[model samples]
Every structure is written in C-alpha cells, then in structure tokens.
Target: MMAGLLGNNVITQIGILVHDIDKVSQAYADFFGVPKPEARWTDAADKAQTEYNGEPSEARAKLAFIDMGSLQLELIEPDLHPSTWRNYLDEHGEGPHHIAFFIEGMKEKVTLLETNGFPLQQKGEYTGGRYAYMDTFKELKVLVELLENDK
Candidate 1:
C-alpha cells in the first residue's frame, strides 16, 4: 500500500463545537481583539439529512464565522438534536472538534485512507467543500479533513 498523503501545505479552518455560541464566540473575539463574529444559519443545512451508521437524522447547526488574522474560526452549536457536534461535545466537552486541511485530491486521499484500514466515521459535503472522518485515532488521534479551496 502507498503511504497516505499527509502534509501541512494548507492552512484551513478549525471547527469548535460550543455549548453556548455567544459566550464562546465572545471569548475568541475578546482574546483576539477582533469584533464579534456574525451569526448565521443554513437553511440548506437545516433541510439536509444524513445517515450516520445507518441512522437517518437532520443536520442543523448554528454557525459563527470569526476572522483570526488570516485564518477563520468556525464555531458551531448544534440545535437540540443529536449531531456530529453533539456527539463530540458529549465525548470531549466543548472544544476543538476537527481540523480541516486544504488539499487538491480529496477523493483519492479519502480512498487511500480507507483502503489502508482507516474506516470512515462520518462523511459529508457543504457548499464550500467536502469532509470525512476516519476512525484511526489510536495512531492518529485527530480528525482529518480534506477541503477544496473555494476562493
């Protein structure tokens, strides 16, 4: 098997699952001395449903986009439903959920990881990019995501 492609060539967004959107967003804003982030919701996301491990459910999340220097920080609060953010909060409190890496070959990279014994924990795509989660934490304890630059 070919070695998986992993590199820090791109600086992507960092997603944090928060219990309180206002408080968490404020903390970052104050710390960075940046203005408060704008809160937004996605109707497409609200209407979108996903199948997780064979269970079908809606994926609705409130989002706040904050500019941190050159990088953007996305703070997500899942509505009163079980979602990926909710699951992460339940397991690891409110903190960093995933780190997205910008790459050229997303499908090929995902296949490489899957074929090399890394089963997908979750996979989804938004208007901006696509993402996947691999259950290879013992060796690589971070959520890996490949994002296409939408500029």
Candidate 2:
C-alpha cells in the first residue's frame, strides 16, 4: 500500500471543530489520560490568501494538538471570524472537521489538486511554510488539509 503525503507522515493529524477548545482538550487529557495538547491561536489568516466561500476572510481559530504515537488529534475553536470552522459548526454542529496531511512541495500539491478539480477553500501562511484546506466534502464527505511546515 502506498503511504499518502509521504514527507514526514501520512494523514498526520485529524482536526476536530468544537465550541470550546480548552474544555475539550482538558476533558480529553483528564478523562482519557492523554497528554495535554499545546494550544495556540492563529492570526487572521489574511496573508495566507484565505478565501471563504470565494471571498477574503478575517477568520481566526484557537488550535490545540495532542501528539499520538503516529497520528495527532487537533482541536479547533473558530473565533467569530469568517472561516470554514463557522460553516462546519453551523452545518454539522462540532465534530470531525478535517484530516490534515503533512507534506512537501505545497504549491505543487495544491496545483495538482486544483487540476483534479478540488478547489481550495482556504489557505494561510505560518512561520515556516503554508497550509491549505480543500473543499472535498461533496465527494469524500470530509474536508482535507495540506501542510508544509519545514520551509
């Protein structure tokens, strides 16, 4: 079997959308005995060339990550900014939001996906590299994210 996104790992993180990030992260850590996840807040994601529903967004989200053996569990609480987080919350009411793959050659991958007809939903640039969320819910029944961190 082929490992997808073969850079650091395949499907490295599963992102969950929630109303309260700290609450859920604490609950998971306390109840499940998992290590507490590192929490951080993202910027407005404007410079990442973010577009929500085909428009620029000033969206921000609180993110937390718990490191599993190979995979990771991410918790995201969308701030009151224009983002897919709000859309997922409004439509699905807090659940598995997206599966992220850590990879290299981000622009190539994004362009490849776009060539295959998976239009980009949102993208943002962080300290290292960049990331993008693809709109695949219609066919795959879930959103997909691509991350390139080792810039």
Query: Best-fitting candidate, measured by lDDT?
Result: 2
TM-score to native of every candidate shown: 0.78, 0.86
Candidate 1's error at 26, in angstroms? 1.2
lDDT of each: 0.69, 0.82
Q: What is the lDDT of candidate 1?
A: 0.69
lDDT of 2 at 134: 87
Tens-digit lDDT track for model 1 on 14-34?
788898888888988899898
Best by TM-score: 2
What lDDT, from 0 to 1, does candidate 2 have?
0.82
Question: Taking the tens digit of each residue's C-alpha lDDT, what string does model 2 give over 23-129?
Answer: 89998899879777877988655555566767888888889988888888889998887688888888999899888888778888878787877888888777677
Give the clash total for candidate 1: 0
